[model samples]
Target chain A: MTALSSPATPWKPSVLRLGLHRAALEIKLFNRDVLSLVLVLFFPILMLSLFGTVFGDEPVFGADPSGQGGITPAHYYLPGMLALSTILSGFQNLSSYVATERFNGTVKRLAGTPLPAASYFLGKTGQTLYLIVAQTALLLLAARFLFNVPMPDEPGQWALVAGLMVLSTAAWATVAIAFTALPKSAQSASTLAVLPVLLLSFTSGVYFPFSQLPDWLQSVTNFFPLRWTAGAFRSVFLPPQFAAAEPGGSYGVGTAFVVLAVWVVAGAVLARLAFKWPPQK
Target chain B: MRTPAPGSAADAITVRDLRKTYRLPKGGTLAAVDGLDLAIGAGETYALLGPNGAGKSTTIEILEGHRRADSGDIRVLGTPPWKAAPAFRARIGIVLQEATDSGELRVSEALGSLARCFPAPRPVAEVIAAVGLDGKESVRISTLSGGQRRRLDVALGIIGNPEVLFLDEPTTGFDPAARRQFWELIRSLGEGGTTIVLTTHYLDEAEQLADRIGVINQGRLIAEGTPADIGGPELRIPRVRWRDAAGHHEETTASPAALIRDISDGGRREPLDLAVVRPSLEDIYLQLIDSNRQEPALTGARP
Candidate 1:
């Protein structure tokens, strides 16, 4: 590695430099965590096998009122599983990593250095992006090759879904980081973030379709980012006219996109305000 | 005093009336660092001597820009540390109390990555050699012994070739030999024009390395001077011990010379065992802390 000599022109420490350095360190450190490796890769594969087999034959929303199955249950569930994979990569992975780093005093060590909080979070964000992209690709490949799921027909729709996945995950990662900052301990953080996400996954129609759920439960699920993300993802693969054939009505692709985007922005803002690079006394 | 050329021997750290306090969860406040003043010149090795909870770490953390002071004027390499300018940080190195556990990463790989953060970091091999870990570069950090891990901590601290270094209990867990070796490493770094601020519970370590020592108690500096001057050698009266002619053990001191002379005047045939003992640095430190504890308000008053 080449070392830069002390510049004759003194360089003022910029927030950007700290952020970049932090991101680099976070990436390096996260890659070394054994739990992170298992969660990002192994956990998703395990979840896919469990859900794919149990709910395999049943039409996801069960035969439409027209007395015909609109799409294979595997096809609809694959996208939701992929979204779930992305969510885990972002929210679960980031929250736990932050909490653990805080507990271990690694975050305190870094704070003492020249690196600023912004640089650290930026580095963390970079790492999360890298992990999420890799996990998403693997999930997509499995869906395509192993499950024999068809790819989205239109290139535009595919782009939209990809954008949504990246944005929604990035947003969730920020929220997770903020949550990690709030929780006092790693155990608390895991319980607070993991339990809620698991609960949401069940209710938001990731493992099973939303149409089969009771009215009040469906109403609560609609408020969650997972529901919209899954809805947006399904819109990309399912027939455009399929929305008009639904019981309550067609899921609005545009509305789902907007909600996910808003959550992402809100999460980023909250993370900026609440995220503590190092725990306070 | 002549100002040293740029980046040469000069004042590397200047802190004035630095203060930091922690607000308790309930309603009270804990003052960790009360108005403290210190200035460390370039290439000088200074030790901040204090007992546990004496605010040594808090002071060091403020200097390192890790914790913001409640109020004070401070400048490290000509910039406020809490501002934490890259230029300021580039010139200073810090070895934290605990080492980061970047698991499964070999020593070489870990140092190599940290080196990238600095604009001008030393060669990884050189750093390893300096810390006396040349042969174990390939070994994972998890597998290293306690002493070796501490050495690695120092290695990472100095990899950036910092003009000033902050070491917080750098040799706490080391055996005597390892501690001595670590002391020698610190001496060499000081010799090479690196301003060093060290905090340790070991009085011997401070006496062995510090050109100037400052004693802090209850968040205030009680004394700041060279080892000899802070507690005057004259004030350390020698104790005279001897076996009198009657074969009775006797120890007396107002002046050891006078006491020895009196014992010799009443001497018998047998040669008397006589010795004069002056106070060690440990004795002086104890006296200082004892006096400080007795009068809390006077603890901050400079001697």
Candidate 2:
């Protein structure tokens, strides 16, 4: 008969060790999935290229001729593509991974371990950040080399945009985590998560200016995170005078940042309350 | 940090009135594990023997700290498993029935990642060798065969040098040869002083691996003991077959040896295709299950 043996030493596990271990697993899985890599990197680039060619030489959203004439189609599409990349990093990636892991009992297996829930999320965030950075680099290179788009003159504006991008992606990733927790299966998660992103991208002006949309559509689109993200990105890249070209001139960067922050906190709370480590029952 | 002195012999695992119930999506509660009490002693390899929907898996899950119980006073290694403290988890390992879909990660890579969770995990190469995946360490998980994947599952379960290992239907889909190999692996682990808790529907598996066996039916433990003790020695009726003078076969006996002696009439003649057969573990299990089914409300009956 085996006796109940106590630990010979006090048990103390580092959260950093747990996070790093999970991150390594996540990165390995992401790299091995060739299809997912291609979609994340090139999907936005393809969308931008198609829209730029189709809408060439047109007066987009009725901006002043002086400011509008100087901007190329690529320049107009670049910010939207960046916003698209952020959405993919958060909603598409997080939801699918969570759903698949849950379906296959990987999460159940992990729940038996000593690792904490926070460490798992930290690892997922690390993977999301890596994908977003890769997507950003690919979009920028394609914009500069293939379309001859002008680079931002002020490095400070670029820094601010980069910071906001990280914040927004983290916020959206939280929302994805919360949403995925409610799904019963991987199939449901993929459909539920991907459809909303696709719909929002279309209505929130990823392919065309929001001003082209009618009043009712604009009001509905404004309630979503995609519109604010696109508007914020545009504010950083476009000149001050070009604000007249956009629906809500100047982008309301402050309000956009605040709303995204609120979503992040709310999403985190929801995830904590509802997320199942190995699922219930 | 010094190890605590070994406590009472009754302290391996102690449960008093353990119960678990869950709410169904359509709105009623399902009692996965009803009020149950069980205890395993030190150095014991105990098997929870039952068929599907017998609540064996639910009981094991609660003990493994993966699920919470609705009502119970349970102590595993002197701590409530569902509390899920790092200290409590460190001494236990679990091998779930399903293989993890880790995708494209090499066998060694997955084990290496899991090793970080423990304070003193076994060497990665040693664990790989123990599970019989020695030369296939570099092979990705996606390419492994079903049996090989199951071996990998065992490898991960023991990498932490856990004192107690829970194996939930470990050989569900294994071939005969693979099952034998797994049995040998389990034997060696048990010989090394690790207490093992296994669940299986295979009667032969329980007979072979368990020092003590427990059979759960519905949401309760119906019978428990060493295999021999489970079906009493006197209850092991043998089959006796012999031809009569008129060429009609006859067979009846509690002791076939005695019956054969009486049939021979104290003098040797020609053998008549006679045979003596002892009751097997499967026969005993079926008899117990049948009796349990016959009396549905029999409470507190222990084999």
Candidate 3:
């Protein structure tokens, strides 16, 4: 047999370099998916505009008894929309991407390569982080211009929103990985992911006021991360008067931070235990 | 059967006493790979042939480092694959039974991305041309035909310039033309001294591509040899068929020439419809598998 003339070998790539390459490829492929891109970038803003245009500025019975200073529904719903955008990108988008790759055998093919386990995960997480950041900026910009929603007036409030965005993205992204680990196929994972996202968003105040729900229901919502995330956003986006309508007549800043932190830890652990490369048999 | 020693550094691949069992979802366990041994020399194209439920895939998976074996000794290119490192993986390429579908990625993009996973990779353009996908390089994977996708899978497998390439039923969905084209590509790769390990149920594919063939059945290594001597030379009898005034007659003989001479001596100058029937690789393969089924594995022994 003749000798195979090998090309000059490059230096062994580090795990970080491998991960960055994978992330770049992931983002390129994701950009080509028009439906998912539209959902991630514009769906929340569109919903915000629709609701703002339709719902009147009239004060509700308990939210504001004095009708003179009542806020419009646009301002009231902006915080919830922001939370929804985070969930859309972090949980729904990430999980579906993973599940589809698994079902199509992309994950198995990659597993057979020299790529490390850490690189595969870090690459996916990096893709989600980039998307969430872009999503946050786009949502906030649309809110400010399209609906006249104000930016955070205080640096402390800005700090609060940024902190919450990071925590929520990391937590939900981890939760999504765990979700992919449970489904037997990509179709099931995509269909099943919607259930928890919808359930969490509805009960956690992304679609309605958490305080207005039955007391028992509010108590149930308290255990989840989305309620705390939405409440944290409302603390920064809504005016001080809106605090009266919140569960404790305040932002619950201490509880929100603690709850999100616990979820981050719990989600990371669950992902560690559940996530399988190439997926389970 | 002739069994090879485990972990022979000289050969590209060596296996011995390889065994793996899977727990049934409903009840008892099932052994997927029983005690089996095999060896393929460096720079040789060795085909592993078997039926659907045979242990061919399980054996390949164990060798590919994708699945763990309950107990076995396997050495591929001087390393035990189960505990192999990144460098070990870089030297090998695998095309699984199911072709990976990265639908949104273009053909070049898919191969280019995978190439980055290896330390020394062939240029993406060269691999694309090698697999005859130059015209479809910019097309998205989803738009490619099944045969085109399979060609791309082969492109990705070779882009790393691996020393050993494992192809599991690589041409399962290819049309006749595509299958022949694939065979040419594989033959070219073998010429370059890459050790090719191919698993397929297609006997003709084995005859055309393999220098040596191993037929695995029911988790056991039942037959192993070159394509011409697969079932052993002793059992391979050429059949003599002839038509006389009365009726047609058939007989299996060690020498067809001797039979023809004897028939001629009986006063018929030429026997009508006389022909020597030589069994093709497919016939031998079917006979070997069929015979094994008649006497199933021992009751206590696992398949």
Candidate 4:
């Protein structure tokens, strides 16, 4: 009989499926976290506008200087902004978030429960994906409409953008989980998480342009994801001629993809090894 | 709610020679839990009472699988929690001693989600009501008062209808009314034959809720017994006091009655202030904790 019973039956967890239960809870919590909600959802769009119009209508550095292909300042900053958004949401935000959870005993509570260990991570993955999707969509809309920053016209270009965003998000989020062990405590999490992102932004052509930075700086930043995250997106957003401005004379999209994929794997392995759930004695 | 507490013959939990030690900063080692042994009858309500760092929380966490004991044999429902399968976890519940809550989820949302993890969970509304959070169901956890959040913690713990529940300082932030209600809930759960393991600072709570109480101090079980008997008959000895011409006098003895008769000369020499005082559980617990304080050298329990 399909009749609704007064008291609930033994919870048929078999029907809920693994990770989904945890994902739902995680999403609900994030939905109401005003600080993180605003930062991830609107911060990118805000950044897009705040910096989008800075060098208005000018032929940005390393783009097609002749103006034959109108790669304006917005075009230059758009990819960097996307990369910055990825770093903010995936790496910095997640590192401090996990640290706070560990320090405050959220992980301890989950650890003691019957909940599958994977569900907690799956929940984190779910939260990160939600943030990444929202941030990317918001930034794209703001760039496209608010700043009139033209998006990639071709489906192939958009597909590649989607691909890079996914890889970067996965890599950064996993690495954030692994990175939680670095700080002495939660109070230092934000400081430590933001330091690298800020430094990488300035040195890795995020706040600046990849082609404009000294060759040595470009070579050094290549080891990190921000340089490639920005480069990968710039290839899609800017015209083919802008590839000339790259250090490798191309976005090195192939290497960028490989590096991010490696980071995803490495981050996962390291996180598995380094993840601290129980409150440190 | 469950099969008459699963036959009182089997212990719901047992720990033998449990030990957990941590290296202190700048050198030296601290034995958080050392050579501790414990057992709880299948349907018993047991409270582990101690001071802030007396290792009561550590012991409970080890049982809950939140921390691993360095060396020992521990069984909760016939399985070691650290190596226990999901089925084993499903049988137990834990309320960790923490201030953290599901950040912004409504009380109902968090409870509802956690309830889905168990095989036989109490209804969401029922658990909420039991914890005195009926009206606050839709309220965000981040906004709940400290007492309310603690109630939510208790709610999440029992939502699963666990056969064995571990509550670490379960009523830490509860107001007097809330604490009383929480005690009633625990009593009802105990009456249902559910085995409960609790760690708390309040001796009255232990007396009110626990069928048996253990006083842990300096990483060892210093004393264990029922509310009336813990700390041994020696510690429970009554003190007879009187004010007379000489001065105020207090004498502790096994037989306060005979002592009173001898001192008062069969009521002829008795003063208005003559009285017999029996030490309460709280008094015994404090004496045990104070006398059993661990030295920096990491010595064992005081002789």
Rank list by TM-score: 3, 2, 4, 1
Per-residue lDDT of A97-160 in model 2, one digit per residue for the tens?
8888888877777777777777788789888988888888888888888777767878888887
Evaluate residue B128 in candidate 1 and report its C-alpha lDDT on the 0 to 100 scale: 96
Candidate 2 residues lying further than 4 Å off, grouped into runs, are A1-9, A52-70, B1-10, B25-28, B245-252, B267-271
**Residue runs of model 1 more than 4 Å from their true location after superposition:** A1-8, A12-34, A55-61, A64-73, A116-119, A239-247, A277-280, B1-9, B243-254, B266-273
Highest DockQ model number: 2
**What's the fnat for candidate 4, on a 0 to 1 scale?**
0.63
Q: Model 4 residue B169 lDDT?
A: 90
Instruction: Sort the predicted structures by lDDT, highest score first.
Output: 3, 2, 4, 1
For candidate 1, what is the lDDT? 0.77
**Candidate 2 docking: what grade?**
medium
lDDT tens digits by residue: candidate 3, B86-156: 88889999888886578889888888899999989999999998899988989999899899888888888
Fnat for the candidates in order? 0.35, 0.71, 0.61, 0.63
In candidate 3, what are the lDDT values of residues A41-68, reduced to their tens digit?
A: 5778778878876785444423534555
**Root-mean-square deviation of candidate 2:** 4.1
TM-score of each: 0.89, 0.92, 0.94, 0.90
What are the TM values for chain B, all candidates?
0.91, 0.91, 0.93, 0.90
Prediction RMSDs, each to the true structure: 4.4, 4.1, 4.4, 5.1
Off by over 4 Å in 3: A1-12, A56-63, A278-280, B1-8, B266-268, B297-303
Locate the minimum summed-lDDT window of 10 residues in model 2 chain A. A1-10
- Cα-based lDDT for every prediction: 0.77, 0.81, 0.82, 0.80
Question: Of 3 and 4, which scores higher on lDDT?
Answer: 3
Better of 1 and 3 by DockQ: 3
Candidate 3 accuracy as TM-score: 0.94
